[model samples]
Target: MSVGDGRRPEPRYSRIVGELRRRIESGELAPGERVPSTREITRQWGVAMATATKVLTELRHEGLVRAVPGVGTVVSAPERATAHAPAPTAPAPTAPAPPAPAAPVRRSTPSPAAAAGSPGGLTLSRIVAAAVTVADAEGLTAVSMRRVAAELGVATMSLYRHVADKDDLLVRMMDAAIAERPLPADPPPGWRAPLDVAARQLWGLFRAHPWLAPAMSLTRPQLITSAMVYSEWVLGSLHRHGLDDQSAFTAHLTLLNYIRGLALNMETEREAEAQSGLDSEEWMDTQEPALRETLEGGRYPQLARLSRAGYDFDLDGLFEFGLQRLLDGLAVLLDEGTPPTRA
Candidate 1:
C-alpha cells in the first residue's frame, strides 16, 4: 500500500537498520567505530529494548556491523574485493529488498587481563561473577559473550580461555551462585527437616537470581555440581522415609519441580514490570475494574467473595502454604508405611 493508503508503516527496526546502514556506507561510522549499543538505541530512538535489539540484529544480518566483545558493536570492515567496487544499484521499491546473506564475523585475538588494564587480572571466577551480575540486573536475554566482555573490560575471545562458550559460562554461573548457600553442615535429624531446608535454600537462590529459576530445568538438566548437592540431600531424605531408589528420586524431582514452578513467576513478573513500568500490584490495580465486572456476572461465587474480602497474592506466603500442604501429603504417606512404589 502507498504511504497515504492506510497500510501500516514498516517495522521500527527496519527504519533504524536503514539509517545505520546509510551511516556505515557513507563512512560516517567508519570501520571498527563503535555503533550504538542496545541501551543507547533505546534512549536515542525512544523504542523498547526488544526493538533496539532487533535493530542491532538486523545490522549484523546485513554484514554492516559486527559485535567486537570488549569494544562493542562496530562497523564491519569492507571486503577487499568490494573496497573500491561501485555501490550496487538500489532494488526497485515495488517490494522490500531481499535480506543479504550474513558474512562470518571475524574474531579478534584474546588479550590478557593485565594487557587489557583490568585490575587484579581476570580469573574464571571473575568472569562467572560478572556474567551472573549481568543476568541478575538484566533478563537472561541481555547476557552475551560481547556483553560480558564489555562488562569485564576484556576481549570477547578472552572469555573463551576461561569459558568454552556462553552455554558453558551459564553453567559456571549457576554453579557459582548455588555454591553461595551450601547445604547445612549439620542438618536436622528428621527427613522432613532436611527436605524443608533444601527447598527453602533453593527458594532463596531463585529469589536472589530471577534468571536462575527459568534457566534451570528438570527435564533437560545442566551439570551444576552445587545444584547436585540439593538433589543428594533431597534424595537421601526420601530414602530415609522408606522409598525405593526410583520413588525417592521421583519424589525429590516432584518437590524440586514444585519450588521451580513457583519461582518462575518471579522472572516473569520482573520482565512484565520492566516492559510495562508497572509492578504486579500496580498492574492488578489497573485491571481491578475489569476484574470486578467479570465477577459481577455471578458465574464464580467463590472468586467474587474472595475479591470482595481482598486477598494478598504474596508469592512467599503462597510458597510456604503449598510447601506445608505437600509435606502434609508426604507425612500421611510415611505414617501409613506405604510410600509410593513403581509397579
Candidate 2:
C-alpha cells in the first residue's frame, strides 16, 4: 500500500500490475514470456476475475505487454516496449516463443452495414446462432447482448427485437443448440437401446459445446422443447421397463444428472484448455513430473498402481462404462417386478 498519499492505498489491480511489471522489467519474465492468465491471477492473488482483468488492462495501458492471436498476452520485445521506460529505437532480435493459451479478445470492428445483417432483417435464428458461436468459442461469460450485437454488427437494443433479454437469449441458445442434433428417427426396438442412444447423444452434445451442461438446470428446468426430448425418452423408457411414474421420473432424473454431472467437467476442462491452450493429454504431459513425484511417494498406493497400469483415461470410454453399468442396475431393478410403494 502507498503511504501518506492522502488518498486510499493503491487499488488491488494496480498492486498486482506493479508486481507483474517488476517481473517483466527485471528480465525474470523475458520479453515474449507468458504471464499468468486471468484465471491464474485470480487463483494466485485470491481476487475476483474482474480484478485480474483490470490488472491485465493496466499492464496493456503501460505498454508492458502485447496481445498475440492464438497466443495470449506476452511481454513485448524490448524494441517494441512502449512502457514509461525510454525507447531503445531498435528492435531486439529474439527467437519466437511458444504460443500461450490466452483466449481471443473480440476486437472486430462492428461490421459495416453491408456485412452486418440488417437490424430490420434480424431473425431469431440469426441472433441465437451468433450467440451460440460466441458461447462456444469464448465460453458463456462472453455472451452478453452488447457483445452479441457487436458480433452481429447491429445495435445492442436490436437484439431485444428477437429475445427478451440475456437470460431469454441463453434459453433460446440452449434450445437451438439441442435442437440442432435431433433424436434418432428409427428406434432400436427396446428400452435399453433408446436410453443408451439418448445418453450418448447428450454426452456428445456436451462434448461438442462445453458451455451447454451448465446452461441447463434440473430442479427448475427451463421449459424448452428440445430439453423435453431426452427427458421424455428416458421417462418413457423406464416406464416401458415396468417402473411407475415416480420411479420412472426419478430414474430419468438420476440418469440425466449422471450425464450432466460428468459433462460439467467438459466446461471446466474447456476453460482450462482456453486459458492454458493445452489439450487434456498435453496438459497432463506438463504435469507428469508432479504426478510421478506423488505416485512415487507411496502415500497413495492405489493411485500408484493405477498409474502403473497405464490407462488411457478416455472420457468417452468412461461415459460408456458408467452408462452400461447404470443400465445393468436398471435391468436388475426391473427384475424385481416393481419397487414397493412408500407408506
Q: TM-scores, in order shown? A: 0.64, 0.63
Candidates in order have lDDT scores of 0.73, 0.73
Q: For residue 153, what is the lDDT in candidate 1?
A: 72
**Candidate with the greatest TM-score versus the true structure:** 1
At residue 83, give the lDDT of candidate 1. Answer: 33
- How much lDDT does candidate 2 score? 0.73
Candidate 1: list runs displaced more than 4 Å.
1-120, 336-343
Compose the digit string of candidate 2's lDDT tens values, residues 79-195: 556655445546544434211211122223435464366556777877787787788778898889998887877888877888899999999988877876778776576687888
1-343, model 1: which lDDT tens digit per residue?
4899888998888888878887877667766677877657877899976787778767776777764322346676564113332253552112111112101111133233533565447678777777777787677989999988887678788888888999999999889878878888877887888989999888877876778888997889999999999888888887876878987887788889999899888788778877886544445556877998999999999999998766645567778888877777777766754454321
Q: Lowest-scoring 10 consecutive residues by lDDT in candidate 1?
A: 97-106
